[model samples]
Target: MSERVIGGHVAGLITVGAADALWAGLTVGSAVPSASAVFTGSPTLARGGYVLLGRRVVAAVKASGGAWSVPEMEVRRAAAELGAVGMDCRDLVRIGPFGSAPAPHPVHDEGTLLRWRERIARELQKPGGPERAPRDGGHRLSHLAGVDWRQILVERPRMGMAGSWWLPRTVVRLLDTAEHTETQWLHTARTRRIDNAVIEPPPHDGQAQAADAWRTTSQNLPTAPLRPYSGELQGLVYSVVSRKPGISRKVARWACAVCGTAPAAVLDHCHEHGYVRAPVCQSCNTQERPDHLYSNDIRVAGHYTRLFDTDAAVWLRHWHRCPGCRARATLPLPHLAAWTAHVACRTQRPTHREARSSRGRKPCGALRVSWTGGHHAPHTCVLTVVVDFCPSGEHRVLAHVPYREAAEQFRTWLAETVPAVAAVAGPDRIDDLPTHFRPVIADTSSEGQALF
Candidate 1:
């Protein structure tokens, strides 16, 4: 039979067993079978027979034969035993898997089985069935301190058969118990702080000095003091130090100059000059790495070193001009600042006076409130810098250095610093350049101003 048919047949048999037990209790003056007893006694072999009986019944059923069939005599004996306990077994014997008949009887029969089903249902509705007692909170604490295999098996029965199915019962039991010992060790290890603790090894004759130096370093570099760097970042620094020449791993563990908080994991250097740059954290290094012009590129590096004295002209000369368009691109600092302020204002509401003025009387004598609460214009004008190199005819922005002071700083870098550097180092030292110079200016005109 198909699994579905078999499952249905098994379900019918359980109902029969329950009904039989109820009948027996009423007729034989015997104690009524508990729900657990009914569930355990039901001969529906496919549905967790091993789980209900624990170990003994599982062994007996397995030893009898394959899961597909059980000994005919064993089935009859089990029926008789259940019958002796006052459970009606006639229906089970007539229509179950152990029954001699080939075909199953109609389940809707108006007879003893039907009455038994009703009686069992009514009995189940009444309270006072078997229940597991509340577990002591202290036992849980004790279990964590040390594992008890017996208690674990009783509480979590699936562990008993979780290993190899063909293995002997004793071996499976042993494996299940041993598995928790490893888990207990892992739990203990997680709770302990042992990463900073050093286990000293016995020193040999010649290595005494090296051992003393190692101990000194270890004593000085306590984990509590190194909270600035994440464990992963520290590991990365150690890896970089081992690979890179001249850079000490110990020094790299210190706080980064650029970020002041994170560890200096990467060795920053000028690609053009082949000179070592100051140590910086990974995040700052990543951000600045993309803008490096050459190995010995001192102009760009100098701008970083002297942040206040930075000139945009010096850095703009390093930018690549598009060969297709022959246009040099420069980012407008003032327009970008206006756009940033516009965006910031878009998130807030306007003053009460502005709100009332903007919402003047409509033609229908009704006031039309500003959709943005008079804080922002209905349409936003985006300010962008157009670079000559855009092959797709799209505007390319360099940086959003808005505000007058910041804009002046960027303009000075482009106009003064770049030319000054070129004057000393020779213009040919700079990368690709247009035949003519383009003046970088801040758009301060009313039309170019950002609309709020």
Candidate 2:
């Protein structure tokens, strides 16, 4: 067979064997050779001067157990004489249902697809072309190329500027020679260095700015002053300091009276001004005055009830009288004096003088003495005894316990004494203290004292 070319270049190669020649000749195109005509010269040339005859023959042979078509008969035929049953002459010569048009091929595997993609990318590497994305539509290849070019530029050459504040030589060169006046777009489009370019100054310092902020705050508040601000308030303060007319002065006297307690560990003045506006010890201005005996009794009971884990009602009920009893016992002019004297006696009892007296036989002739009836009897006589040392006819004697039992019995005696008033007053007595015993002093001036 001679060399065949179409459109000025070799299109396909040809060979002659029984099956190949048959297949080639049976092609329907007008340019094709007939099967019988080609096979007619085959047997004669089998051993003749055929240089490279083996290769040509091998190419001409069909593969084993394969099938082909015979166009002359228009039917499928077996490759009987060929070394193999069929040969894919698809590359060499086109012969199929749609003659010169090739059959569709199978889809490429991943590796082949990737290889084709890389080839496409390399071919597209030159500037102007339609841009193509990766398998998943990522511009990965373009990004990689950009990054590689950036790395090369960064590592390869250093461009310097002329003046102190001049742009870098690379930037100046790129700007001077750029195709468009929009140099920023050109820089972003062409070079990867745009990402690293400096655009603006550094951010402001928030902390330092905050530190320089203007601020305002109030100070030196004048708390409670010695005198109130307005005239009305001043008058009010004066009024409170001074007692009103026709009021009893017992409260005033009691308020001003300095408690005779020692160490001065009690309030002696009222705190009417300053941050702490309450009664305080005059010395320290911090402690409260020791309260009245009656007030202190209530306070102590209350304190014990609150702080000592005792039932307050039970504790209070033990010592406190109903109002009527308290009034009846402690009120009335005579009762007042008696109560005062009783308290005085209790206060002075520790220092009271005791007078000795004889027990058994009184004086007769000489003093008759008896020592457990060993007979010198002391004489007995009726004599007037001086009692609580009242002048003349008002003498009264009272019995007292021996010193050994006094302190121990005092609590019982006190308990007994307290209930006596309540029992005497009975249940239906009036609540307020009797008017006569309620001390009344002249309220002539407000120079001192208040708080009955």
For model 2, residues 98-172, the per-residue Cα lDDT tens digits are 112222233321101111122223423435422433324332332210011111111111125111111122221
> Residue 192 in candidate 2 has what lDDT?
29
- Tell me how far the alpha carbon of residue 16 in candidate 2 is from the true structure, in angstroms, after superposition: 99
Top TM-score model: 1
Off by over 4 Å in 2: 1-218, 227-343, 346-451
Whole-model Cα lDDT of every candidate shown, in order: 0.26, 0.21
Candidate 2 least-lDDT 10 residues: 214-223
Cα lDDT for residue 65, candidate 1: 20
Best candidate (score: lDDT): 1
Weakest ten-residue segment in model 1 by summed lDDT? 90-99
The true-structure Cα RMSD of candidate 2 reads 54.9
